[model samples]
Target: MAVKGLNRPVIPFMAYLLAAILLAMTPAICLIPLVDSVEVWQGLEANTRDLRAQTESGILLSMGLVDTGLKLFDNTLNHEMEEAFGPVVAEYERAEGNPGAMDLSRVREELDGRMEIYIINESGVIEYTTYLPELGYDFREIPYFYDRITEIRLGGFFSADRVVAGIPTGEFRKYAYLPSPDHRYLLELGLAPSEFHESRMALKYGDAVRELVNLNPEILKIRIFDCLGTRIVGEECPDDDRRLSLVRQAYRERTTLEVENATARELTRYLFVDLSDNDYASDMSMVVELTYTTKAAEEKVAGMFARQGGVLLFGFALIGCLCAVAMHSLIRPVRNFVEDVDLIASGDLDHPVRVGGSEELVHLGESVSAMVGSLKETIQRVRASEEAIIRHSHTLEEQVRERTADLEESNRMTTLLLDIMRHDISNANNVANLYADLLATEIEEEAEAELLRRAKAGLAKSIEIARDVNTIQHIEGGLPSPGPVDLDRIIRAEIERSPGARITYTGRPVEVLADDLLSEVFTNLIGNAVKFGGPEVGITIRVEELGEEVVVSVEDDGPGIPDAVKPRLFERLSRGTYKESGTGLGLYICRMLITRYGGEIRVEDRPEGGTAIRFSLRRAGTGGEP
Candidate 1:
């Protein structure tokens, strides 16, 4: 058994529509998470790259300062050698050919031991020196010895970092040679490291690196390593051992390497790049490693994800609301229509079904209501016919002499019922038609006026049907006798009775065989022409005598009936044209009345334009004239 009062279909329909809306929104909702993830990851990578660049720049800056210090030191050394060597060479030249004659002790004592002077012969022997450890030292088999000897021989000065036995001393030294007068011996001077901490340039370079490090907290360590893998400036980190392996890989691969510690939430990056200029080594490079905490970045990403999640949820709720509104608008009216159908099926024909929705659905409801009304009317007629049949059967069993009276009484009752039905229903229809006409006159909207016009046509049709029923009853009882009816006077009288029309007629005493109903036929035709025809319509009535019959025509400048519908114009409920509205009984009744009066009626096209309805009737003779 089905559940009562359950709107089973409505639930599923609404669900289906809502599901479709969700499906449409799914792609956008899914992309939100992916976008958030990409944004967070990109942000971290970008920060790491920027920090690595700053670290490399700091290391390069330190290398530049160290080079500047070396250049300044070399310049000072050149000046000292020129100052001391000029006097020493003067003494050695005085005692030509005597290498021992050059007293280096006096020279070293005069400079306060800041300089070292050495005397070497053409045989490549260090004959005299200020420091005793360098006495009898051989200058032969050294590139510096032969190169300096050649420079002296050429009479030009040369300076270099004086390296002994292929090992570089930490001290920087310069050499200038003075040959004896005979060019057999040379004097060389060198400068070595001393307490130069107060040098402004050197202190500036050192202080700058420290200041840079302090300014950016992200930089955990800044180291400057020379091309020979020796620390040049800056402190070496305690964690250098762990990070050194990756630093070597960065050098070997000639690229940067980054590593992150999950437990510490720290990120370390190693960059290996060449120094642009350095006095320590030619084509030199260094490794700069920077380590920073990732906690800040991670926290930022978390906050971003939280905000994005909130927005996504808000959008989801908004979409759900829109779906709900759509479902209500689309489904509520359909549900009401279904419930009304249920009520109608249960035999509640009199219950009003409030209708709304799309045009097609509204039209559907209206057709249903009309069907119910027709059914009710059919049922009432059936009941009345059954009662009449029973009464007739009972009258047949009455006394033979009173049978005629019983039959006449039955006929009278039937006639009276039809009259009451026609009178009451026709008056109601006329009142409705009058209201429809008034509404059509006042309404300015074309659509509203069209509806009113249709309503008026409907009411007019109902009235025509009632009149047709009366005519049918009269025909069944036998039509009344025809008498002399003046065609011209009847047309004039009908035209006068009908207002809101223009009728052109000339009175002519051409009498025809028609009853009092003769004027009704003319009234219907004239009214139809004025209603359907354009405003300012002109109607002409013409009557002619035909010896034994007379022909009367009513012509109007209205849209003519189509050939297709003309044959059925006189058939009950058959409208003659698409533009013709109402119960087609008007023309049908005219045809019936004409036939009853011993006359014939037909329609034709007018010669100029419009339509002509003509009918022939028997001419009224002197004997039966009215």
Candidate 2:
């Protein structure tokens, strides 16, 4: 007797198939939009940056042109000024680095009040000058300026600096320097003309920033700030606290910054640009701020994303439609084929397996249909044989009764009768069991399924008993001599046959004095536990090697047998109170098999509840049991 497996929840074929398809396509559905969004963002970001770079480049280009123009003007003007001072410079050098020995009155007269000359020593201190205020002033106090003067002293070269604000006075002026032939002095000239200042302001950074803003529509406003966060370029607009803070932040971090204002639909970028020749740590870096109106670009990107989402949704819907169509063409036919096969297997002999699917499935259906037809024809032949065997059984019984005193003839007739009866019972029970198994699968209701399962189990028990009936009948003719039989092997084979029956057994390599028919004893005891205890029963098989005998016990946690039924429990046709459908031959067959093998069989109530069948066999290769 085997316990039935629990039924699983039923799922419709279409729903299962659709769910699987959706699950399989989830990554594609999610990843397509994700990849698209990344590419879109990257493209928009690249375009925005390229445009910003163009605006910055325009402003820088103007700055470059201004510097070039200033350098050219200063170079030409200083050459002429240096030539006019050539007489004064030669007179001083000839006097051996003595500014007092040279007369500058003529040079001053030649340049009118536009030019002033200063004499700097090797120590970068102004020793004498036509400008009296700077005469004793040491250029070394200003490290950046002093480094340039030191270069002129060592290299004996002349190079005019950009127009810069004069020290102490803060007045814009142009300066040029030259080293003496002996490298003991540096000659310098300063010039300040009102018309020149007016022209230079026109070519500065603020005018360049304004021109860039007017040219680039995307650039809403442009401002340049020094490291101190003071606005130094573009129109004087009211600077907010946040703007000043970000300017300083960018300068301090030496990195670029971008801020977007959603309400104003503007984006501001801060860039730090250092233009000073800072070999001596003179930092003249400015944070260039450029604001761009992003109303149009944002709108364009949003529209593109909207269109992309719409196309993706349409593709997703198309995929869903394809999945539906596939489920109809593929899964529906298979679902039908399964239902039809189940129906045919449930003993509907005349019903056809109506299937429509691939050629292989159709062929398989036809083959199964032919197999069912063959089974039906074979069953009919078996039924015919059974009837013939029954008729012969009756004739054999009648012949035995008439043969009365002839002992040999009676025994032979009884043996023939027993053999035929056992064969007939076995054939019939096998067919019944086959139908029961088929019908069990089609049953969906739990209540009905349990009943069918119990019925099938009963059929198994009946078959077991029928096969052992030969043992009981052969007792009179003389049974096979008991030999060493592997007790563990028989128990294990029966356990495998009983699926889902929870049985516990600790195995040992033990042989007992029993013939091969000993397996029926275990089959009967274990199957009896399962039949009486139902599916939740727990059974344990144990073998103990006594001094001269092996005692085997099969225990179950089923309902313990009543004391009233204990007296005749092994009698033919006896049943317990649990009363599962059976011919009561299970235990009787066990008793007969054990008795034939020189063992004793008995049943007792397990202390923990339920029944335990204990039996003792003469241990193989040993004397009889004490």
Q: Which candidate is the best by TM-score?
A: 2
- TM accuracy, model 1: 0.35
Residue-wise C-alpha lDDT for candidate 2, range 1-626, written one tens digit per residue: 11111132334456655666775685487567757876987898798878778878777677666656665665556666556557656767777767777666666666776777778897878887887877788778766567877886788666666566556455666777777777788877778657377766666677766777787678877888764566666666565787889998988788889998889898898887756553222344568898899877788788878877787788777777867776676677678767777877787777666555445555666777778879988999999999999999999999887778588787788778878889998998999999988998898999999999888777877786776566566654576688888999999998999888999988878878887778778877877788789999999999898888889999999987889999999998887776474677777878877887888999888989989999999887776522
TM-score of each: 0.35, 0.38
Model 1 lDDT tens row, 1-626: 11222322324344556667675776587567759777777977697668656756875677566555655664565555667766676667665657566566776777677767877766667777775666676656555445556557445443333211111333334445556556666667655445242442344434556676676666666554443345555677677677667766776676778898899888777667654332221333566666767777778777777877787777778776876777787767678878887887897877666555455556666777788889898989999999999999777766664978888899899889988989999888988887777777789998988788778767776876887787767766786588777777888889888776888887677777887788878977897787678557889888888788888889998877788978888888787545556677788889988988877999999988888999988888844444
lDDT of 1 at 171: 39
Q: What is the C-alpha lDDT of each candidate?
A: 0.68, 0.75
Error of 2 at 371 (Å): 37
Off by over 4 Å in 2: 1-37, 87-110, 121-144, 167-170, 180-184, 198-215, 224-232, 235-626
